[model samples]
Target: MLVWERPEPPDRPVPAPLSRERIVQAAIRLADADGLDAVSLRKVAAELDVGPMRLYGYLATKEELLDLMVDAVHAEIRPTGDGWREVLLSLAETTRRAAHRHEWLADLLGGRPQLGPNTLTGGEAVLAAMGDVDLDVVVPAVSAVAAYVIGAVRREITERRAERESGMDQRQWQVTHGPYLLRLFATGRFPALAAVVHDGPHLDADQTFRTGLDFLLDGIGARISP
Candidate 1:
């Protein structure tokens, strides 16, 4: 049975006034500071200055707490306008921004089907924007856009994390690696890759994301008639 299904003992003394919101916020704080692995019921309770058992009143399992955290962040995604394309773009950007604020969120992206209320509401906004689009393609289209957003954001986070660990910014990393790649290019083992390394622009995070997103959206648009 779910935690909510369990009833309080009639004679049990009432504990401190804690709520799910408070617990979830504490978990989010822990995650933001030390990454997702840092968040635990015990840690959250400590953060809240309460005993670990006190959290059981608000949440049952760690998975439920994680679900709540994901939903809480989903609440930040507010799609503007009624146009399906615009709404989708807004959703993607909003999600990216949220991930920026909560780097640990990258680990959870697309890892599960978040069924929390706020998550569903954000999804509803995407579908509602689709309007009269063919039902057959609506879900697929939404999935495609979401996949792109999640994948792109995750890549961005991974690269940034690598940069942080290596003590090198993007430009510095490029300069460090570029010479070795050029040497490999001279060997003619990877002509195609050589061409890219030699000719391709070293786009910053925003440029790389927007370029990929535009391409993804354009491909999706081809499937939508008119």
Candidate 2:
């Protein structure tokens, strides 16, 4: 979440002071360095060398700041894209990279996305890419890819953040606690999961994204063509 306050442009008459853009950029930097929870208006003001109350002219609330930050990150993904498939693929990859860069982003950006302009435009671009396909495949295709990407990103970010936050890497984590999870899986209801539990992080997000995307495309192709 982000914390934003109004900026009083009239009260703080500075000699070339910080712009809203600058404030947001500062916020982004703060977020990148200290994680999202650190992005308070006071902290942002501190980063910009200004009073906390002086920031009120730009944004109103924490939710507004978060929305702007989300939109800002979305804007960074490059709105311009090529053809439909290329566009969607680029969007997917761009989103994945963006989320990966900010490990706390995925949970903040859940599966059911908000209708911010950037968010809507990004979705429109994806749906437009499958322009030739019928709604059936197109709808499922979009949802599947989106859902898969969100899930992949969420899992990746949370795991890495947890490991980093805990000061323990996966190997030690597995060594200490894998047995309990293993025991739970030993009941035979989760054979596939059990098989992978011992294997470690065999497939990080890149492979998983590609695999799920390919699976969906293949299925769509089969259904539509045959």
Candidate 3:
């Protein structure tokens, strides 16, 4: 059973009370600092200054803890705006921002069905914001935006990590590889590809994300009955 579905243990009188919230928070901190691989029941117990066995009252396994952590982060995604498009835009942007704040989130996003309280609430808000659309339209519309957000956020985080590890920004990385790319493109055989490399807009990450999202929304708008 999911951790959220199981009722939390009643508070016991102890020098330092240990609850699921504390356990999840400690796990999140470990994940935020050193990525998901760093998070474990043992580490979280240590962070809380409790024995590893003490955590069993609140969590059954590491996967449960991960689920809680992901849902906890979802609390940061607050959707706003009046119409379906505007609301979905808000949801997508906020979800992206949340992933940026918690880079480990990219690893867990869309990996499983998240039915935690906060995730359910966010879904409810998004569906509610869709107003009176038919269920088929609303479900697909929300799923499309969500899929885009997950894919975009994962790609953005991957690039960001690569840049950090390589100690070079995107432009610097491109410049470093310029000679090889120049040689590859110099061949007259690849005209179309060379043209884009030489003349592309060179948008920053945020601009690129927003632009792609807008294009997607426009396409969806065209399909929606007015």
Q: Which candidate number maximizes lDDT? A: 3
Off by over 4 Å in 1: 1-16
Error of 3 at 69 (Å): 0.6
Output the lDDT of residue 34, model 1.
88
Kindly list the per-residue Cα lDDT of model 3 for residues 1-226, writing each as its tens digit: 6678787788865756889888888888998899998999998888988789889998899988999999999999988898889899999999999999999999999887998999999988999988887887888888899999999999999999998898999789888999988898888878888899889788988999999999988877876766
lDDT of each: 0.84, 0.73, 0.89
Where is the poorest 10-residue window by lDDT in model 2? 1-10
Better of 1 and 3 by lDDT: 3
What are the per-model C-alpha RMSD values against the true structure? Answer: 2.7, 4.6, 1.3
Q: Give the candidates in order of TM-score, highest first.
A: 3, 1, 2
- The ten-residue window of minimal lDDT in model 1 covers 4-13
State how far residue 57 of model 2 sits from its true place (Å).
Answer: 0.9
Ranked by lDDT, the better of candidates 1 and 2 is 1
**Model 2 Cα lDDT, one tens digit per residue, 45-118:** 89888888777777777666677778778875653466555665677788888987765568677634565667
Q: How high is each candidate's TM-score?
A: 0.91, 0.76, 0.96
Instruction: State in Å the error of residue 116, model 3.
Output: 0.8
